[model samples]
Target: MMFAEGHGLHPGHENLGGHIRFFNLDSGIFVRVRLPLLTDHCVLDSVEGLLVLQRDEDTAIHLLHPFTGDIVELPPLTSLAMQLKTDYTEATKLKLMRHISASISVADDGVVRVMVILIRMMRAAVATSQDTEWSMLSWRVPSHYQPLSTGGKQYLVHDTFFEDIDPDVAQVFQMEAHLQDTPKLIVTIPREILAYPVYLVECDSEVLVVGHNDMSFTHLAVHRLSDLVSERYVPVKGIGDKVIFVGGRALCVSSKILPPTTGNAVIYQHPRELTFSQYCLGSSTWSLATDECSMSMSGLTQGPCSLIPHVFTCCSRRHWNKGLMYWRDNEPLTWKVKQKFRDGVNHSHDPSLISPTRLFS
Candidate 1:
């Protein structure tokens, strides 16, 4: 499922009611989910199949399940400000909430853990189901590091270097344990490559660092890191038979899970335009998946969109648009485009001229 906030028509089309859209990957279907509470909210992150939406009304954060329409309300941002003993105005509180980065992890036993990085205070906090309270810890995270959570662990990645935060401290928010080993370095990028705007993605059990070079063209280098404690980051020619989707969140899917045509490719949206393209790793080329007519007509470029890999579980099946489509096994996933609500109108771009993949050297 690909989730996009705002309008489905053009980029920055926030005025089209500011609804949440869900594109079903299995059947190429689009479902628009409306959030009344999120009228003035901003999405901080998506994790464990839930979206973290921060309400502007009172600076409260909400956990919204797009499909089920279930919302879990967390404590407000003012609570954290008070706990930190910091006096802040409402405007400052709102600004701080917007800049903070967060991640969520859920265990098999249904234990949910949330970690947040307070960029303003340069501190971190952890909240868990057991405690039901925010544990603020004093760990000065570098301004460069971005918080990422995978498999119940939180990490901070900057360029080629990544540091794994101790899960113990993250679970209980123990400042002492975190202070003992502040920013434990796990991996570093090789000196030969100039990696800027690097993104860390966890696929299965492996961690992949994708570095995009924008100096000449938009070239990308993929490096696989060893264990969490290992210092080596080895370059990889390919990612077997899987397709990766990169954006605010990076996701990888096995070829068996998606259409064979999408195999061995990297699918991503244009950072500056309302368009999406595929980078074929095998052929080292870029191709447009959606035609210009469809893109322009649908106004698909207006908001924050995601390429989600969805799986169908039940043996029962349904088909739309064409012949029989099976849901079981590694059936090809569909792509969806959506929009959010904002105040301004967005201009459309010609996707033909915006070759995100071709920019790579």
Candidate 2:
């Protein structure tokens, strides 16, 4: 199952609201689930089927299970800012402006672990199921660190190097643990690729580092990190039989599990539309995922939208034969797009000029 959560008109602009939409890839069925509490909050990330939502007013973060309607409140952003000796107002503004990445994992013992990276400050906070508050951890690396999720575990990668954080200290906050150890460099980025804006995606235990060029095109480099000292980066020409979804988080899956057409492709969001485009790795070209693009404008006129790719699963392996499912939701418009023209030609659409008639009635 794949799900998308976004705020938009419910079949019409008569009512604007936020909803968690579920798409059954196999059955081609779409269901919209309303989330009232998250109506005004910003969804930072989704992991293990739970959304990390931050309240706009207070910068309070919470875990929301859209399907079960379960909410777990974490320590407010003010607490984290205080730990860094930063002003709360400025911290809030920074978070809203930047793309904040987070990772959520559930241990075998049922303990929920969450790690949120504050890009601006180069700091991170960890919250566990047993914690009453979030524990702030500062990164010693010069370049900013990005969080990656794979195999129910979270890892951080800087420019071209994988930085290993102490797992023992990550679970339980020990101030002394910060001085006891240093980050170990695991893999190095290939000299041929630009290292900035790199994204780490774990597929079937193999780590794939995707480097995005200035042209918005991507190159893939694979590595096996099972042994830190012996691991090395290997350049790959293509990803066989697997389609990767890249955005706030990178998800990799076998093409056999998804729709037939999605094989050997990378599904990523378009810069201008709420829709997604599939980049066929073999051809090194892109085409719209027409099925999903068709539903992008169903009830929306003009607004900012976000697509979250999710997979739903059942408890038993016997039921897994139903095949893999993908879901996505449209996010609400949070920023206004200013109309600008280049060379006396109208190059952009003004949200103010959007016609209500274009919305679904």
Candidate 3:
């Protein structure tokens, strides 16, 4: 969890520079660092590793690590505050300032990457400063990158984002990926791009189980982690929506109108339609008459909403008013999940829980 430090400047300081502090519940440690203060309560601006508080002409942007006491000043054009369209009024800018913190995940390798959203302000629109954003903007810590020990208190990773950046662009980190050359097949089924994946199971270190985007079927693919490369995409399966790895078996979610279950169980919302029949893997086919629904073995990060990166399982519960939202796996949940709602949450076993060689065993 992150907490904003108060009392740095003055009591009535509205746009006072702020700092981000993080609390590790597992270790019971609280660390704080100086950051750019918010300029406006409504208009918040964020980029890859920085946050800006903007209200009218008074704007303060700070490039700081919430987990460490590192700070830098970013060029105006590169901050989200300056990326807004020329026609945008102060009110609209305030309304668009959104949270930019991304969930972090650790892979079998020690590398950590943070996913972010990037706005190609110049590429999207010439006249207006407002622009469309891409989801792939991410920051990462290489596997070999080591953190500096701060005396006997905390270990701090090097702040690479603060080093150098172009002044004309705004980048946001929304997700992270490990850069180990672990060979693995990643298949994005057609049409399932927007749906909550049903599952992500494991068969072996070499085999993975996943659902299709359409939420209509499932499939399996095998890969050798040692064969992985950079900026590469490999297909794993098609027409599936769920994946799970239990013992030696991998399960894929399928709503196909087949033996046990009949009729297309997928519901659709325009532009993104569901799939049809799918080939499910891992578990033996069962008759729906047995009165069995899907049982997830993973935990969901519940919030005002939930974001599922790939098909896995339901979060502890539903969001305030939405259904199962987007998926986010391999990331730690906030204290709200652990403390405020303990009984309502479910913990999933990590795929790495077993030996990678177990697949061959």
lDDT: which is higher, 1 or 2?
Answer: 1
Using Cα atoms with residue i matched to residue i, what is each candidate's TM-score against the true structure?
Answer: 0.59, 0.58, 0.28
Best by TM-score: 1
Model 1 sits at a Cα RMSD from the real structure of: 12.4
Shift in Å, residue 98, candidate 1? 2.7
After superposing candidate 3 on the true structure, give the runs of residues whose Cα lies further than 4 Å from its correct spot.
1-21, 25-57, 66-68, 76-87, 97-214, 217-361
> By lDDT, is 1 or 3 better?
1
lDDT of each: 0.48, 0.47, 0.25
Q: What would the per-residue lDDT of candidate 3 be over residues 183-276, giving only the tens digit for each residue?
A: 1222322222312232222222232222243333332232212222231335443324322221111222333312243321221111231211
> In candidate 2, which residue ranges exceed 4 Å CA deviation?
1-18, 24-29, 56-58, 87-99, 105-111, 141-146, 160-183, 192-197, 204-206, 212-241, 247-249, 253-262, 267-279, 282-361
Model 2: which ten-residue window has the lowest total lDDT?
315-324
Candidate no. 2 TM-score = 0.58
Clashes of each: 24, 12, 47
TM-score of 1: 0.59
Candidate 3 — worst ten consecutive residues by lDDT sum? 148-157
lDDT (10s digit) by residue, model 2, range 1-361: 3243222221111243544455653344677777776545655555566766666456577888878889877766655655666555643433432244566666688776776655556555677767766677655423433456444555565552343542111110111211212334444444344344555666656866655433244433333344322433344557777766666456675665455445666676655445566777677677765454434432233222222233312111111111211222222121111111211322111122224332100
